[model samples]
Target chain A: MKNHVQWESSLFELIRRTSVDLPCDIEQGLRRACKTEKKSSRARWILEALLENVQKARDNDAPLCQDTGSLIFYFQVPVGFDTNALASATRLAVARATRLGYLRQNTIDSVSGSACATNVAYGAPTFYFEQCARGTVDVRLLMKGGGCENVGKQYSLPAESLGAGRDLEGVRRCVLDAVVSAQGNGCAPGILGVCIGGDRATGYECSKSQFLRKLDDKSPVKILARLEDRLLKESKVLEIGPMGLGGNTALLGLKIGSMSRVPASFFVTVSYMCWAFRRRGAVLTVRGGFKKWLY
Target chain B: MALLKPRRLEYPFTPEQVGSLRAGQFVLVSGLVYTARDRIHKYFFDGGKSPVDLKNAALYHCGPVVIRKDSDWVVRAAGPTTSIREEPYLPRIIKDHGVRVIIGKGSMGKVTEGACKAGGCVYLHAVGGAAQVLAEKVVSVKGLYFGEEFGLAEAMWVLELKDFPAIVAIDSKGHNLLRRVKSASLRMGRKLMKSSDPFIP
Candidate 1:
């Protein structure tokens, strides 16, 4: 258990590196989009500036974006693993990471609006702990920026009107409407996660969970899979393309999740993520000794 | 002799003038324009009193970067903030104050479109995040309507600008370039998504 706790602290340092660090995958995505959407000079310039900013951030060990964002942690723990000491270690690691990462203290007291320079706060590292069948601890850390966070929306619509059961087309419409409402404000060429069915809170949780998935993976559910296809199709038709300067790509990808809903109510929620997808994850193991796998 | 500038540069600009201005176009403005955002809009709409007269004036959608010295305010970075944040109150502000030009980034909603057409005003989009560059164009910091208590980012600081660069996004004829661009791009994106291989197989 002591060994496991030590591994957790090491994982936090790695997460901090990835949070402010510009990973190669995100850089590749931005570059590919820039080449594909060459017609938009302004969009190209914005992307180039962002790319330059990323490099500068890495070189100087500065935050990649000004909004350091709230720290969100998703933990998938083994069912039988002792988890009592994990919280205290995580808090210490977060405080240490804030100093190491050079991340701005963005969390403000809601009432007084005074910023807590240290990242650690009451109930922060906003843990969503899940006991999984898998025999290892997997933690994903996301620095979700405020610009894209402002655009998240959830709504419950009548089930009968759209389709008999949950229609994929109706889900697609809802996602499209969300993107349109966002305009360029969410800083377009953004990504979105949608969850269909479930109550409001659970639906949002499912949507956010989708962010932890690998950028390359596709949706698992067939209905949601088809909805992802349709949403990608319809959203680009919005012309809210890259940075809202108007281009071929408005959204990078649409990931969807689903759960069964009651016949009376159909709830849908969409969580928009900006181009600055600042997140990283890692797995730590102490079976024989401390080992870390950064993702 | 130099050419005479238009004298009656007030609210309800002519349709012809609006059509000429494109997104990213630069124009030298020489007239009265007020400044307001979330706080001031709320103050007037939320039934609070105002010190300045808003009639026949343009309300810039900006919260300026300013420095103060001996009671005088100096403009530092006066770029437009995202306009869509004030979408709910913009139409009412335009109607109530007879605002002519709305300078900000992003596009407005349907209500603003109707208001622009009905009130004969235009929505201009200033380049976002170009604060330091935009501040160079402001010749003087006319006066501030609101205090710094509202936060430097949200307070309404009146500015007198010259040659402020902007593109006419939504014009009096109800034409919005932002929407047009979005629709066109969306059509292209839809086509590309449908094909199994967007590129040649």
Candidate 2:
């Protein structure tokens, strides 16, 4: 077995490095969007400024943007592993990473109005654990910034509005409304992860889980598969183009996931992701070695 | 050729000049503008309070930003916050105060638009997240209005600015570049989607 201290140190190091730099996909997307949007002077200017900010952040080792975001950790643990020890070690790792990351202490007293710069709150480093038969642990770190998080919305559309069988059109309307309503607050040319057919809580959870999927991953389920195809087509139609400037691309991608819902309800939820979708992941072995997985 | 040179503007700007201004048109404004945000807006609107003479003045949608000495405030970083948050109360505030320009990021909704058209005012969008860059434009930090009890960051600050850069995001003519851009993009999107195999081919 590998030493827990070594594992914790490695995790902290990975978190610190990823926080200050723009992820490769985000960088590529922005560059490509900028090139395609040259005619749009406003879009080009804002995008160039954003790109400049990214470079400055990376060079200076600053948090990529002012809103460093809340930390979300996803853990995939091996079956038969000692979960208790892992949890404690993970907490220590997070606390150490928070200190070294020089991240803005965002946690504050919501009611009492006190500030906690350490980024550790009552339920911070929000953990979602999944047990698998594999003999290794996989961890994913996602810093969901507030600007994008605020635009997330969940709705239960009437079954009749979609269609007699399944109102796919209603789903389309809700998604369009959500993006249009968001305007530029969530930062335009954003990504959206949508969940269809789950109960209220699962609907929201699945919406977020879809963000974890690879940008290129194809949907596995049929309804979500169709919805994804249609929503992507219609989102650009809303004209909330890049950076909320008029452009050819309003959204980078539309990802969808679905779950069983009650016969009477058609629940659809959306989680918006800003241009800087800061996330990283790693796979950990029992031998104390790990490989960075998500970027 | 350069598109247009930046111009410095002041209060009592003519209707003709305001009409020429379009959302997304950049301008350098020099004048006295008040800094107010959520807390001050609520206090003024709800608390039955009036602090400044509102006629022909500008109300910035900002919670700028200061550090302290023994008895005074010094601005550290003052920039525009997102403007859409104040859409609920902006029209009333503009009418009540006879305010002219509402400066912030993003676009305000229909209510503010109607108020701007009716009240002969405009909405300006400062670049979001450009706090440090925008701070260079402020010539002086004038004084505070209220909410000092709240904190340095959240208080109502009265700022004296010169050559403050901004874009008219929503104008007196009801021309909103944000809305225009969205409409144009949506129309193009429908056409593109209607065509078969429209995936960047």
Candidate 3:
């Protein structure tokens, strides 16, 4: 038997914090971007208003955005831990959170298109569990919004269009195309996660997983770190600005990761996350107490 | 073109009131606004009558977070959804409802622009992703329709609004701010793509 009660309560708190609180690093990035823009520009004004909204939501303990988004949980556990128990606990916690209004009832039945008020419909609250050498259980949650999700793109490289080849240059073109296409629709000041090589589904998954890294963290690979910096600087030139109004600062952060691929295929997937990037995690001890908080 | 000053207007606006709004201007709307998304729009397209009067009313494109209190419904977070998704049905909705103002984010398409001109309606762009701040303007929920069927997010929420701020993204005169941004950004992207800067394709 597992500690259902304690785990449920802790997961509820995690959901609450993830929905209401803006992570410190992302907040800092917004503040920095706000300073560099023209004082009277729309980008600056939008950032200012957003920072205020963040404060208001936190102070009032209210959800930061109306679209609480699809709740996705990523769990890493010790080899011998029971994955089924953890998944069940997560479902119960999601249900409780929906009832308590910590999260909006976002899950729906795809076929029937009915609102599953419990937010625990089939395949809802997507879970990814993996076994690791560590003894502690680490769970991360990300609230992926629909608008941004709609804008995510995948490119099969070595293409004649845009004169892109199956190279790092091709990846750069693919990501830029996505940012340009999204314009103001995906909500500006977007954070992007780019995966250079993988199959279609796994490529998108890997791209979204890159969002777990802190906004300022540098990629261990020198070339990828350089690409991240370059893309971050170049995306501003698109001038999509905040809310798609004309100004500076189109993107706040860009994370790049790559995986090995078959010689015949070169795939690049780009995942866009809106400014309201709600993501948080915690390490839970067996007793269900928070061992530590992860950004 | 000169920038128009932001205006404040109440519900039941006339064609003249809508004509006065130009793209790039701001507006603060007060009074009652009806909320509907994908499903409710389809409902209207399928010949379903609007539960409430929409004559010269502001139609908001949103799926709000509403919770039922003791007996009343409270809007916890009321932010605008992307407007482009409703492009196929907007022209008809504007014509049928006699809607003067359509509030949403991400400016609609050419069809909507033409409809706004023909129907004498204006597209008001709300701040995207600012649900809590937007919810503050929703004073109260008058009532709700389709909650049991389409779910809370897709239901038609009748809300009483006070000083709801938005920008005139597309005006009755056919000017569109979002279109301008998109074209300008595309041009810039092309220019950047052609450059010899190693990152460019």
- Among the numbered candidates, top TM-score falls to 3
The ten-residue window of minimal lDDT in model 1 chain A covers: A158-167
* Candidate 1 global lDDT: 0.65
Against the true structure, whose lDDT is highest?
3
- Runs in model 2 lying further than 4 Å from the true structure: A1-18, A38-40, A80-102, A108-117, A157-170, A220-230, A284-290, B1-20, B28-37, B44-81, B91-101, B114-121, B127-166, B180-201
Candidate 3 per-residue lDDT over residues B108-133, each given as its tens digit: 78999999999989999888888888
Local accuracy of candidate 1 as per-residue lDDT tens digits, A1-295: 5665566557667555755576566677778777866543555655665566566556645455544567787777888665656766777777766655345455656787544646777756687778888867777778776667888988677434323234555565466668866767666677788888888788988888887766656777665566677667667556666657666567777788887777887888899877767778777663412256444
Predicted candidate 3 versus true structure: per-residue lDDT over A149-185, tens digit per residue: 9999999987677777888887887887888999988
What's the iRMSD of model 1?
8.3
Q: Across residues B78-185, which tens digit of lDDT does each residue of candidate 1 receive? A: 556567777787777777866667877776767778888887777876555344445556777776655644554455666666666555678776777777776665
Backbone clashes in model 2, listed as residue pairs: A105-A117, A162-A167, A163-A167, A237-B186, B23-B168
All candidates' chain B TM-scores are 0.82, 0.86, 0.94
Question: Cα RMSD (Å) between model 3 and the true structure?
Answer: 1.7
- What are the runs in model 3 whose C-alpha is more than 4 Å off? B1-5
- How many clashes (backbone N, Cα, C below 3 Å) per candidate? 7, 5, 0
Q: Write the per-residue lDDT of candidate 2 for residues A1-295, one digit (tens) a residue.
A: 2488877776676566656666777778778878866553666666666676567656655556444567777888887777667666666776775555435445656887655645667877677888998887888777776767888888777534323134655566567667776766676667888887888888987888777776656688766676777777677556566557555556777887778888888888889887767777778786446754566
Arranged by TM-score with the best first, the candidates are 3, 2, 1
Model 1 residue B49 distance off true place after TM-score fit, in angstroms:
15
